[model samples]
Target: MTGSLQPVLAGVVTALVGFASSFTVVLAGLRAVGATDTQASSGLLAVCVLSGASAVWLGLRHRLPISIAWSTPGAALLVATGPVAGGWPAAVGAFVVSGLLIVAAGLFPPLSRAVAAIPKPIAAAMLAGVLLPLCTAPVRALVEVPALAGPVVLVWLLLHRYARRWAVPGALAVAVVAIALTAPPARPGSAGLWPVLDPTVPSLSLSALVGLAVPLFLVTMAAQNVPGMAVLTGYGYRPPFGSALRVTGLASAVAAPVGGHAVNLAAITAALAAGPDAHPDPDRRWIASVTAGVGLALLGLGAGVATTLVLLSPPVLIEAVAGLALVGALAGALAAALAEPDAREAAVVTFVVTAAGVSLLGVGGAFWGLLAGGLMLLLFRRPRPATAPAPEDGGTVAGAATPRQPGRRPGRRGVPAGR
Candidate 1:
């Protein structure tokens, strides 16, 4: 009983930490994309249920700790992209398209390879650019509303210094307290507490497809799915990459009409369930992911409340918390983006264009950033000399034999015979 309970507790913690750490970012992204309060709530609920289901299915089917999550980085991309040409419906359509792209990547190896062939530094630079503004929100909040944001920042700092893992959550708790104290109390029976799916009829637009869908798919694949597989591999689990992508892609498509943006494999939260802390035996760690899936599904029921909290709180305060959660991600992205000296200049171009948040010709900064970076890389990258094929057993160069003395080997120059 104790053995079973340990994994269950770990799973619960995984779900809690995953949800608490970044749900604000999800909401903010949905809002930025023009989702209404109710729509954002529906998006939250849908992703939780879909991601939870994917996690549960993959964990059981593969018997591996395959954790799933909504694409937090993709959400950040949406936040950066802001409203599209056709409003929220177009965004929904873009979500559907991105889901299809993910499914295609899973089904077609060439497509997956094409996506993988994107230079890592350029991808990381684009992500870093998208993350820059959000990561600065905490400082802005500190300056703008010090009284409300001060305690939250202080708690986060203290915990960040000592605990690290609980830093964002600690800050979130204080922010909740501040909200409860300052914000007006909710009237009884004013809002429903149960999860609600407010479906929208998706309408496709060229700009949304190019600017939103493409970038969302790329960001989700590069930042979330890839890192997720790496996390599982690090824990000695060989993730079923194709199957995971298919499952998550299908879930994202199904949930998109109802406001869910995207769902993919979990990266940071994966370590919780896949790690030894969940189980003494590695083989049994799947139970932790399964339990976490159920917990996340259960947590989906509270989306209404979570949405209400966001609607009630000052947006900047919530942004500050979300920003705090993303600082580490930003740092990691920047480091990876600049790691290759040859790619540094191109990466900088990508980062600058993306961080500029400028839109041109109806396309978002992310797409432009990547395009500019790729061009820079192509134009500025130094060409390498062609590698020559290795010699055969006789050490010939390009099938041409070297002249040598009749009694001598290749490296016995000036030596007496039979020495």
Candidate 2:
């Protein structure tokens, strides 16, 4: 009980942070895609439940902080494709495709290798590019609603500098309290809190699926799954790739019918919990992730409460906190990407292209950033061969114990040949 308490507490905090960071993004994306409030709420519930379960299962197995969540990039892409496509049914097809792509990525070694080979500079550039819009959104909202947006921004800046770890959640708390105190009028029919859990029968259309599914799948794999693997490897834990992929895939498949679009490994949030604060023993930290899973599942059980919070929270606050909290990650990731010499130019190219905000074939800049960076490296660099040094005094300099020249025996230097 003594040793367990800290891990349990750490896990609970991890889940709350991860949920707070990701849940609003998913909800906003769904609403943009034309989901009714009830539909969007249900979708978010499915996402949290699935993420928590899979993260716990994986974390318990590896004893690593293996967090899982809905794909932020996929949600962003959905914002674009959802309205163009018919509705939720089309989105489901996309979800299935995303799962399939993730599975394929796990199974294919070459793809992983190629992805790993991407220069850090390029990856950083791409990440910065993706986050740019999110940063501006809050400022834009401030123009529309200064009372709510202005305070949230100030809170975000204060927390980011002084108490960054709590910035987003804290700002969100302040915004909620302020809104409650103000008691703004709610538009009729917008204020109800019920989210129907009755699963809708699955449907598919080839045209809609092809257009929507391909992009969604690509976004999930390139933006979320690839980076996720990078995060694990970067931190020195080599997960069983096949098992992780299968679990995420299975989780996504199960959750889709209930409205979750994609479920995958969490890079940023998992990294936070995996750090020293979560647990001293690397092996023990998984308990935190497992705790998060259980907590998420419990939260799912009270879907009404979760729904109410999301509904009641102002969009301006969500944007401000999310953007400011993520500012640190964006900086860190970009620095890593840019730190290396050989990869610098290509990484810059990837960053520029992605930041340009050009979307081709429904794929976002995150994917293109890596892709362009890879191309730049291929075009510019050539692999050099390992250098083999000549032996000194007939001894192999490359760690061979025996003398290379037969009769020229061993000696510290010119001490005549040894017997």
Candidate 3:
């Protein structure tokens, strides 16, 4: 009995951390795009339910740990772009387009290849740019509302130095308690005080389609889903990327009417549930991810309670917590963007352009930055040299690499006889 507890504990913590750390971002993103209070809460609820169900289904079907999450980068993209010209309805249309693109990427090899062909540095730069401004909310809240923000920052800093995984959760716990103590009685208007699906008929507009739809699809795939697959691979689980994308895309489409943007594989928290710490036996770790999915759905159903609690504080407090939550991701993106000298200049160009929040020709900065960076890479960087084969590779490498030079004699086409 005691032996089984570790996986369960890890699973619960993974779910808790995933929710507490990012839900505020999702809510803020919804509102940024002009989601009404009901619509925003509804979107949050739908995404939670869909994410949990997908995670459990994938975990059970593959017998592998798969933790699903809302697209944090997509949320940041929304934050950076602000509300579209036509408001929330148009944004919902773009959300639907993004989901369809995900589905297409999975179903069509060429589409998937196109997404894969995006340079890693450019993608990393765009993500870092999206996250940079969001990660500064803690500083703003500290200056604006020190009494409220000070304690949250202190607890976060202490826990970050000690128990890194628990840092954001600890800060969130303190915020919840503090808010509850100082908060006024429950408000009269919240989405029915329970999870309810309030669907909106989507309206398509050119600006929303180009600015929000395409970039949302790109960022969700590049920053979250792709790396999430890599993270699962790092944990020794080779996911069938095609099927994973397809299912999650379908889930996203189903949830979009209610404001859910994108639901995809989780990279950061996936490690928490997929790694050895979740369970000694690798085969049994799926339980943790499955448990996480169940936990996410439960949290979704109870979102009203948590939402009410969070709303009591000034909205900046929520942003502060969210900013703190995203600090690690921002750091990672920046590091990856500049990791190689060849791409460093191009990556910096991408980061600066995207962060500058420049929009042109009805397209957002993310797409332009990526386009500019890719162009720079093509012009400046040399193609990588072909790799040499290991000693064990035998004749396959010889045939591919040596291919009998045009003037060489047949008897000694490839390498010197003895040297």
Instruction: Give a tens-digit lDDT track for model 2, residues 92-210.
Output: 66667667666665667565445434444554556556555665667776887788878777887788789765777777777777767664556323424554563555566555465
lDDT of 1: 0.83
Count clashing residue pairs in model 3: 0
Clashing pairs in 1: none
What C-alpha lDDT, on a 0 to 100 scale, does residue 335 get in candidate 1? Answer: 80
Alpha-carbon runs more than 4 Å astray in model 2 = 80-82, 114-127, 183-195, 198-236, 301-314, 333-419
True-structure RMSD, every candidate: 12.4, 11.5, 9.6
lDDT tens readout by residue for model 1, 1-419: 58878888889988998899999999999989999888998999999999999999988888888889998888889888998999999999999999999998888867765776788889889998888888888999999889989999999889989987688988999998898888877542122567789999999999999999999999888888777766665555556678888899999999999999999988778888877789877778888999999999889889989888877788899999999988888888888788889999999999999999898877889999999999999999888688995432211101111122243223221111111
Q: Give lDDT per model, in order.
A: 0.83, 0.62, 0.80
Ranking according to TM-score, highest score first? 1, 3, 2
Clashing residue pairs in all predictions, respectively, total 0, 4, 0
Query: Candidate 1 vs candidate 2: which has greater lDDT?
Result: 1
Model 3 TM: 0.88
For candidate 2, the 10 contiguous residues with the lowest summed lDDT are 394-403
